[model samples]
Target: MKYSPLLSELISALTCLPGVGNKSAQRMAFSLLERNRDGALKLSAVLHNAMEHIRHCERCRTFTEEPVCEICRHPQRNESGLLCIVESPQDVLAIEQTSSYQGMYFVLMGHLSPIDGVGPADIGLDELEARLKKEPVEEVILATNPTVEGEATAHYISQLCDSMNISATRIAHGVPVGGELEYIDGNTLTHAFSGRRKL
Candidate 1:
């Protein structure tokens, strides 16, 4: 079916979003036009505003309207000389949801993918090293994803921390709380076994 120029343009723009295909874009377009026009308008306004105003926080690389993000500015979030390094703002959000971490953070935004031309500088490692030198950082937490690139990034960061004499630790990855042994993969099982602790 041929869409009007405006509809066709909307569908094309929507496909720019990750995982949004032509069909999904069409469904979204129709849903907004037929059932949620007001929501669509509000979303457009917010998207435009965010695109214009959102920037990476100088302190942690998280998206923020100000120079420093709320997490970096919160008085209760005093660093205590510990910093958690993650691959993206989403990882920071996931860790924050656990209410477990109590220190500061460094968002890499991307993993180390040499084949893709992403390197230490591309992911803000130099900046992180500078911060570590300036601050009395006692520990560096490697919280990057459990992918090959994530592992490489974590290893590089760990080496940097070692050279600086700061202890580096990695977040444990293993079977989920409700996961069963039968369904577990070999890599996860190995990690779970290697990271096991005594009762």
Candidate 2:
């Protein structure tokens, strides 16, 4: 069955989202038209508003609406030199959800994926170094993902820290707290074993 031009356009636009294919986009488009036109209009309005106003924070690179992010502006967060370097704004949200880290964050927005032509300069490593030099940062936590690109990025940052004499630490990657040894991957099990602490 052939869809109208407007319906085809809606489906095509929806397919731009991650994990949303042609079928999913068609379903979404039809659902919006059949059941929730008002909700769809509201969503469109919000998306437009956010697209117009939201931008990366100057200091940390997280998404924000103002000149600087709230976390960068907040006076209560740790100012004594602890910084967590992460891959994206989503990582910032995950860490903030923990409520355990009191320090600020530095979002790389992406890792070092050379095959994709992304390098240190592409991910704002120079800006990070500038921040380290200008600030009183005593330590930096490498909170990049556990993937190959993430490891490369972390190592690169660690080397930079070594030259500057600043302490750099990688976030421990291991099995989850309640994970069964048999269910976990060999790499994760090995990491957990190696990172084991004295009980």
Identify the candidate with maximal lDDT: 2
- Report the Cα lDDT for residue 116, model 1: 96
lDDT by residue (tens digit), candidate 1, 1-199: 7999999999999999999999999999999999999999999999999999999999898888999998888765654777999988998989999999889999999999999999899999899988888877888999998999999999999999999999999989889999899999999999999999999
Candidate 2: stretches off by over 4 Å:
none
Cα RMSD for candidates in order: 1.6, 1.4
What's the lDDT for residue 154 in model 2?
A: 97
The 0-to-1 C-alpha lDDT of every candidate, in the order given, reads 0.91, 0.93
The ten-residue window of minimal lDDT in model 1 covers 73-82
Per-residue lDDT of candidate 2, residues 85-112 (tens digit): 9999999999999989989899999999
Model 2 gets an lDDT of 0.93
